[model samples]
Target: MRTLVIGDIHGGYKALLQVLERANVTKEDTLIFLGDYVDGWSQSAETIQYLIELSEKQQCIFIKGNHDVWCHEWLLNPEIENHIWFRNGGKETITSYLTNNFDTIAHLEFYKTLKNYYVDKKNRLFIHAGFSSMKGPANEVYLTNYRWDRTLWEMAIVMDKRVKKHSSLYPNRLKLYSEIYIGHTPTLHYDTDVPMQGINVWNIDTGAAFTGKLTILDIDTKEFWQSDPLPNLYPDEKGRN
Candidate 1:
């Protein structure tokens, strides 16, 4: 069985489908989603529906993202106008649900069931966002940081490349994992639209919510598949702008 890890989807349902088809996933495969499944694009409801259906048929691991958390809060209290969420594509998601009469209750439950992170037998860590105070997988000062922090990735990016010295200095930074996979912070921000790897940490959010493509990487083989650039798929979309 293969382990496929997908990056932030951000409501790009068409892109998500393309990546899945390109990856050729099967029932035996382990599907790991890095989250941000809602918000952005025009089909958040449809995206969640497909994900719910996919989970029923396969071994699926859903990691909660910051956007997902915002969505969860909004779902639980729709009367509270969350300006931040609404400005950042939440409006589109709500519209989709209202238009389709989607099952908000089931979707909310699905969100509640998502994990903040997952560690495989191999000690590979999968998280929506890396934590600033992540001493180890089991030690985090603020649990929500696991889905909202970008300091870990930033630290990894600026850390010295000397493997030995870097490891010695920040021994606990990512020492608990053989490798770390994260989303939330798009790789495109660093000028690359593909996964960025540094010191055993991999940033796989290729900014599919913006102009970048959706990416899926095989945890073992490291082989990856990407959907076409999102702007091409939805020409008039502003996505996460």
Candidate 2:
């Protein structure tokens, strides 16, 4: 079975569908999503609803992103707004729920069930963001780092190429996994619109929240597919701006 890992969606349901279609994903495949499912464009609620239903039909692993945590908190207490979250795409997500007919109960449950991270039998690590511990994510001291950390990816990107994995200079955190996949920090930050591969860490968040396209990477083959730029898909909205 193919193992496909999807990147940060940021409420671009149209982009999600386009990437899945472009990738020709099958029910037999294992789909791993790197979260941030809501809080961006006009279809945040629809995206969550679709994912809830999709999980029932196929094998899917959903990692909780920082944005997803904020969205979940707001869902639990819709009345009292989290000002920080609201300023950063939460308003758009709330607006989607108000205008859409999604099942809030199921979506909330889905949020509750999201894994902070997932490790495949092949020893690949799938996380929304990064983990700081050398012992891996399971022993992470600050669980919030699973959704908010960027240091892991940062270290991977800047490591000296000459430092062999066996060398003491190599990072022990990265040494624990065969490969690591993450999506909190957008690749667009580095001016790329595609997945950024750093040693064994792959950053698949192609800035779908802003101007880049939604991306899906085939973990085994390293082949990937992307939707049209998110801005093009939702011309009328300013996603996560």
Candidate 3:
């Protein structure tokens, strides 16, 4: 069974479908979505519905992104004003549900069930974002940092490869996992639109929320697939601009 790790979707349902189709995911495969499933594009509601259906048919693991958490709060109380969310693609998500008149209970349930992080038997860590504390993935670290921190990735980007010396200075950060997978910081930030590898961390967020594509990688083989550039797919709309 193939283990596929997908990056942030950000309401690009067409991109999401294309990436899934390109990967040829099967029932036996395990799909790990790194969150931000909603917001950005005009199809956030459709994206959530598709994921809910997909989960019933496969082994799907969902990680809660900051956007997902904000969306959850809004779903529970639509009247709440969150300028940050609304400005950063939340308006589109709201329009989708309002236009479609969807019963969002199922979607809410899915969001509520999402995990902050996941660690497989191989000791590979999957999280929406990284942690702030130098401490590795543990219960003691602040949970919110798991979905908001960027320093962890930044540190890994310039880490020393000498295991012994590095482990001595950053024991908590170094000794925990065999590899890490994260998706909150888009690869576009580095002026690239593909998955990036830094030391032992793999960043799969190719910026589907903006002009980049959605990416999916096989955890074991490191093989990957990407959707077409999102701007091309949604030619008429401005995505999170």
Residue 166 of model 3, lDDT score: 47
Q: How close is every model to the real structure, measured as TM-score?
A: 0.95, 0.98, 0.95
- What is the full ranking by TM-score, best candidate first? 2, 1, 3
lDDT of each: 0.88, 0.93, 0.90
CA lDDT for candidate 3: 0.90
**What lDDT tens digits, residue by residue, belong to model 1 across residues 106-160?**
9999999999899989989999998765467467888888888888888788877
Off by over 4 Å in 2: none
Alpha-carbon deviation at 84 in model 2, angstroms: 1.2
Clashing pairs in 2: none
Candidate maximizing lDDT = 2
C-alpha lDDT of residue 64 in model 1 = 93
Reference-based lDDT, residue 190, model 1? 92
> Could you tell me the lDDT of residue 173 within candidate 2?
95
> Tens-digit lDDT track for model 2 on 1-241?
8999999999999999999999998899999999899888889999998898889999999999999999888889888768988988999999888898777788889999999999989899999999998899999999999999999999999988889889999899989999999999999999999999888999999999999999999999999999999999999988987
Candidate 3 per-residue lDDT over residues 40-74, each given as its tens digit = 99999999999999999989999999999989999
How much lDDT does candidate 2 score?
A: 0.93
Pairs of residues clashing in candidate 3: none
